[model samples]
Structures are given as C-alpha cells and as structure tokens.
Target: MEDKTEEKKVISIEDRIPKLKEERKKKANRRLIFYLTIFFILIACVVYLQSPYSNVKEITVTGNDVVPIEEIKELSGIDDETNIWMLQKRIAKKDIEGHPLIESMTIKRSLPQTVKITVTEFNIIGYTEEKGKYYPVLVDGSVLKDYPMSYRGDRPFILNFDEQAYMEMIATQLNELPEHVLRLISEVSWEPTKNNKNKILLYMNDGFIVDATLRDFSDKMKNYPSIIAQLDPKEKGIVHMGVGIYFEKIKKK
Candidate 1:
C-alpha cells in the first residue's frame, strides 16, 4: 500500500530574510520622515514667533467720540512694537475701560499684525451743576467729575434739581429722544408737580418751552419739531405736554 500522508514543505529563514529586511527598512524610513517633519515644524514656529512680522504694526480705534483715539491707545498699552500673539485681550480691555467716558470696550486681533480696539463710550447728553462745579451727565445716568470745557455750550444746562435721581431721570429721557429733538433743547429743568414727580421742562432753541413728564417724554417730545412747524415761528410761548398736548402762548403785557 502506498503512503497517503502529505509531505510538509520546509521553509528556510534565509529565504524570508530579504522580505524581513524590506519591512524593517520601510518602518525606519517612515519614522525618519515623521521626525524630520516634526523638526521642521518646530523650526518654522520659532522663526515666525521671533520675527518682526509677528509684531503689531497698527492699531485702529473705532466707535469713540468723547475719548480720543490716542488716549484709548495709550491706555491700552499696546503699540506698534507690541507682539500680537502676546497681547492679553482681557487685560487690554480693562485698561481701556478705565477711562471715565468709556462704557464698554472690546479688543480684537486682525491678521498681519494689526489690532482693532472698538469702544462704546458714555454719551454726555447734558450737564448739571452741583455746588460750584459743573458735571457732565451720561446717557446711563452717570455723572463725571471732569467738566467739559469746550462742549459745555452745546449741551443743555440742567437746574433746580438737587436729587441725583431726578437728574438721572432727565438724562435717561433726553437720551431716548431723537437727535433732532435733542439738538433743539437748550435747557432742561426739573419742575415736578404735586401729581407727577417726573415732571420736567424743556426750553427749546426756537424760543418755545416744552412741559413734559418723564413717563412719556421721549414719545411726546419727538412731535416737538412738527408742533413747531405748525405754529407761527415768531410766536414764543410754553408748549404744554405734561397732562395733555397743547400750545399755550404767553400773553404779551
């Protein structure tokens, strides 16, 4: 009987030696390429960070009316030589907001070494005199200790109200009025009645007085220009709007 068992093939380590070497070479090449790529990236980062191209070349300030752009830049402590990557936005914001006129501020980094600083400043609607000093009142009912020397004549002078609350109410109301109506106001005085504590009087630049309450001062005062347009421009009198909207011409003696 012939043997039916199958013969097992003999495998030699010498025959597989070339394949093993090829696999090892491929792995080594891959590892070397990876290490070289990592080294190049590290070098590139160092070069970019150390170069002057990474430094802030310009800073633009926007949304500033009361505070000067130079002042804002100075307060931020960032200049052309400042590194854009090293700038701490929170710290810069805090510094810029330290100004009495600035209400809020934001700092942003623009590409190619530029920083933009946008600020929202408190609008000085009018001025109120306390004691001998004249303080500028902001839209948010905040009074600044520094008196405006140049713009004093442009804003209305608030008088006869000693309480800060009343002054704040007047400021808030004036802030809500339109720019045309605000420009028409030459003076605002706190004249409270027995019935309404928010009563205030507005003296117009067109030789007319407005009696309005803080409850609806903005809504009622907006019609002032139209009201003036309807009446005789030469006539000077009180335009009553506290209780009901009407015109009361002062009788000439």
Candidate 2:
C-alpha cells in the first residue's frame, strides 16, 4: 500500500507528459510569432522613413518637356508638406494625363521621399500654316499653339483622312519609318481609295515626287533606298511605283 501510494503520486504528474510538451510547443510558437511581428514592424518603419511619405522631399521630371513642369507639379498635388509614406503614385499619374500635352505618364516613388515622374509628350507631327502662326496638329487631330510659321522645314503635310483618326494613325507610323526615309519625305498626302490605307503621295525632300501605292509598303520602302541610288532628282517625273512601278514626267514645272 505504501509503494502504491508513492507510485501513484509520481505517475500522476509524469503521465501528463503530452500536455507539458503541448504547452511548451504553444509557448515556442507564440514566441516565434512575437519575434516575427517585431521584425516586420521594424522593416515597415524603416521603409516608411526612407520613403516619400515622410514629406515631399523632391520632385523630378524626365522624358518630358511639352507639358510644363509647373503644370505637372500642380496636377500632382505634391507639396513639401505631403507625407512621403502616405502617397500613392498612381493617383499622381492619372492626374498628369489630364494635361492636354501629356500622351502618357509614368510615376515612380524613390527613396528619401522623392517623386520621379517619367512622361511621354505628344509629338507635333503636322502643322497648319494659318494666320502666319503654325498651329500644331495633334495625333487626335485637335490643334494647339500659335507659333511662327516657315516653309523651310521638312514637316510632313497631312492629307486624306479626317482630322481625328488621321492624326493617330500618322503619329503611330512616324516612328516606324526609317530615319533616312523620314527625312526624305517632305509631305504625306493620304489618298485612301476605299480599303486602301497605303495610298500616299510623298513629296520627297530632294524635289522628287513619289507616286506610291501601299502594297508591300515596308518591303517597297526597303527597296527604295537601293532604288533611289539609281534615280536622280533632276530627272523630274512622277516616280509612279503605285500599281505598276515606274516613273512619268510632266513636260514642265
């Protein structure tokens, strides 16, 4: 009876081994969680202090000029008092596009509370010589500005399509053209005859006229660099490479 009593006393506490291990495991888990939480909080605080949320420390502009800096800054609503940590870059980006001059904008936030704004301004592709001031024609065909006009430049004249869609199509194609070919083109007259987007008249810079049809457009253009090598500008003629490729001349100017 004495042995049984002592054995029971020892076994009673010892039998709860599973429970003790479980308690230890739970305690360890809680400690691990606490440490991780603390670590994350420290990281967040460090990041916050380094970011622009502390204040609008600096505003930078790149790949932009058409849109005035003051206008972009105003639209951004960024000030020296702004919390660098609390700012959302997308909000500023959307606001920047509100300006007529900005075609697209990218806003990025950098360390030390700086806002880096990268912008793509719309190209001034076509101009109308009106009132002795050159009114710039937008890709969407809406016009802006009243600057002095001169005919000495190689500005392409837009013809054929209506103002709105024409502006966009031309703007898109301008970049795809070869730099050499682009310079040679003095005027671009759109002669879209039902389902033909490629029909155009290129009044070349060398005083030569190109009567071209759009078929094999890029290929034909590639051929032209070699072809022009053989042709001369002094030989004034309709360089008709349209349907049947050849040249025809006017008797006089």
Candidate 3:
C-alpha cells in the first residue's frame, strides 16, 4: 500500500508573470530617447539662431521702374544685417510705400536669407511746367509739388491753366482718353471762348488741332481716329467738336 499522507504539489503563477521589471526598463529607455531628441533639436535651433546663417544675405525689389532700386531699398530699412527671422514685414511695407510715387507694396521673406519687395507706382500722366522746371502730374490729377523732374519725356504738356479748378477738370478729362489718343496730344491750352466757357485747345503731334470743351472732351475725343480718317491726310486744320464736329482749314501760316 502507497503512503496517502504525501501532499500533492501545486504550481505558483511565477511562469505566467509578464516580466514587469524588464518592460519597465524598456519604457524608461524609450522616454529618455524622446527627451534627448527634443533637447538636441532645441540646441540646434539656438545654435542656428546665433549663427550668421540667420542674417539676411540678399534683398531684391521688383515691379519698380521710376523709383531707383537703391532708393527703394534704402526706404525699406532692410539690409544684410537684418535678421531674416526677425524681419517685420508690415513695417518694411509701410516704409517703402511712404514714397509719394509708390501706390502699394508687398514684402516676402525667402527661407535661408532672402527678402523680396514688390512695389506698384502711380502713373505719370503728364507734366506741368513752372519757372522753367517741370513737375510730374499723376493720374489722380494732382501735381507733385515737391518733386520736380529733370526732363519731360513724351508726355503731353498742360499749359495756360491759370485756374486750379480748370487744371483739375482737364486732367480728369485727359485720364479718360485712351493711350493712343493721349500720345497724339502734344499740349493742351486753356482758351475760354465767349460761346464756350470751358473751351480748350489741343495741339496734336500729327500737326492737327482739336477745339473742344472740358464738358464732353473725352466723349467726343474718343472718336477722333474715326473722325480724322474722313479728312485729307495732307490738310492741317482745327477740329471743332461741339454742337457739331467740323474742320476749319488753317491757311498756310
């Protein structure tokens, strides 16, 4: 007979345990690696910020014709020493647009140190002469009182406009005309007539003269090409555009 008093041996759960200490060690290592990566990234950023690479190496301006590039750059107040990351775009834009001729401006920063400035300038419609010096007139019908140009190019001349109101009115009328028509006009003189109060005379580059008023000058002048086509090319005359359009031949002067 076997000894029945021997206790049956039972297995503990040690084999089923999930190795908690090893898993904990792995997690701690992963957390350390994450923290180290962030620290290195921050250090690199600081180093780069302190280096010369953060400075603006180049600045460019575009869409500028009348305003000199150097002048625009000077007005922008941005240079090689300006930190690209610290550039104030709005401030730069405001500074550049402070120029009377500049209508609008835009600023952009290119990574790794480049800044680009683009500007749109007001159109120079014509010129007004004073004391042998000429000042440019803008499309808005205002003369650059403080700015005098060295020369008058192909732009038409506004002459004999003693009254500021008449000058402004004529400028507005001229602005409405087409570019081709504008080029044909050499000069405009304020010549009021008894029958017409706002009468003006236009001396055309093609050797023809136009007599009209500020009231409907643009409306009637737009058909000038078609009107002149009906006349003899060799004949020089004054085109009267009023209640009726007629041509008065000027006898050989």
Candidate 4:
C-alpha cells in the first residue's frame, strides 16, 4: 500500500492575492508621487512668471566706440520692464546693428536680472574732407557722411578722390599694405598723368613723397621701407615706384 501511494500539491488565488495587492499599491504610490512632482513644478513656474523678480533690472553694453552708449541702449528696445526669460535676442541684435557703424552685435543673459549687449563697430581707416568737414572712412570703403566733424590727423587724409569706384579700390589697397607702411602715409592724392590714369601721389610723414600707380600698389609699397633705408635720410625726394624705381632729388630752394 505504501509503495502504491501518491501525493498532490496545489496553491489557491487567495494565497497570492496579498502579494499582488502589495505590488499594485507600490506602483500606484510611485505614479502618485510622479504626478505630484509635475504639478508642483508647473505651479512654481507660474508663480515665477508672475513675480517681479523675473523682470530685467540691469542692462550692460560693451565694445562700442563711435556709437554712444546711451544711443545703443535706446536702439536695443530693451528696458527694465522687459521679462528676462522672454528676451528676444535676435530682435535686439537686429535693431542695434541697424546703425551704419555697427558691423555686428551679440546679446547674452547673465541670469536672474541682467542682460548684456556687445557690439563691434566698423574699422575707421581714414577720413575724407567735404566742404571743410571731415568724414570717417571705413575699411569697406564707405564714408560716414552723418559723422562729419573736425579732423584730428590721427589717420591719413584722402584728397581729391571724387570717383567712388577709384576710392574703393584705393581703400582696398591701403588695407592690404602693412601697418608700418600705412602709418608713414600722411596723405593720398589722385594725380593722374596724361599717359597714366592710375597714378597716385603719397605724401609721407617723414617728408618724402611716393609716386606709384594703383595697380600693384600694395605689392610695390612692401619694399618702400627698404628703398627708403638705402637713400640719404636728410635728402628728401620723390621715390618713383613705377616703370623703374629711382629717387628724384627735390632741389633745395
């Protein structure tokens, strides 16, 4: 009878009901915590948006020269009443760069209540005179007509360059020349000969004059320092760089 006996084991749903209930409770509790966190975050955002602390309280401007600080600030279209979080960086940049002198600009947010603006102005290469007033010339060969004033002689003066196209070419050439060569030039005049339409006269600060054509002007001027070094410093004369390089002495009166 013992050899023939068999045993059976079974589990009922009631035995597993408590474990399933515990697992479901844990999942529901986690879901509830997640919802509460999201709800609190949304409420905090709304409160912050309505608070006065989110408004811009300080504005800073830097890297500007010809354009006045006050004028740049006014052009930015931003003020203390603007919300720091709602600032339109592109709009502000466009408005500020609309000025002729402003080449580019950048806007940055410095946290809680500060906005900063930086600008880069065009490089002032020289000045052109019109009606006894001097206007600044930029590297791009544009003259600032609205900024006419007295000449300080800090930069070279462009004289008798009525043709805009020629002036632009000359500006490009000057930009290509080395800084040392540029500083030595006090004045540039359009002195065309019957045979040469591009002839130009450069009045040097060191009392010497340079005669050359606009074509290859930058390349030729590179050797000017070496040429001047070989000449008698006390004897001022015209250094001809066209056709052949030679020095014609200015006879003492």
Q: Of the candidates numbered 3 and 4, which has the greater TM-score value?
A: 3
Question: Highest TM-score: which candidate?
Answer: 3
Backbone clash tally (model 3): 0
Candidate 4 lDDT tens digits, 19-67: 9999999999999999999999999999988898888989899998777
Better of 1 and 3 by TM-score: 3
**Candidate ordering by TM-score (highest first):** 3, 1, 4, 2
Higher-TM-score candidate among 2 and 3? 3
CA error at residue 60 for candidate 3, angstroms: 3.3
In model 1, the runs with Cα more than 4 Å from the true position are: 1-12, 129-135, 147-149, 152-155, 191-200, 211-219, 244-253
Q: What are the lDDT scores of the predictions, listed in order?
A: 0.83, 0.70, 0.86, 0.87
lDDT of 3 by residue, 1-253 (tens): 1333332221224433457667888999999999999999999999998898999999889999778899999998888888888988888888888888899999988888999899999987788899989888887678998888776456789888778788788888888999898888899988987977798999998899999988789999999999999999799999999889999999996
Residue by residue across 1-253, what tens digits does model 1's lDDT show? 1232222122455668899999999999999999999999999989988999989999999999767799899999998778889998888888878778888998989998899999998788888776667778888677777644345466788778678777777778888888878888988888777977887888888889988887678888888888888999888898988668898889999
- What TM-score against the true fold does each predicted structure earn? 0.78, 0.56, 0.84, 0.75
lDDT string, candidate 2, 210-243, tens digits: 7765444434554566776777757776677756
Q: Which portions of model 3 show Cα errors greater than 4 Å?
A: 1-18, 150-154
Give the per-residue Cα lDDT of candidate 2 at 115: 81
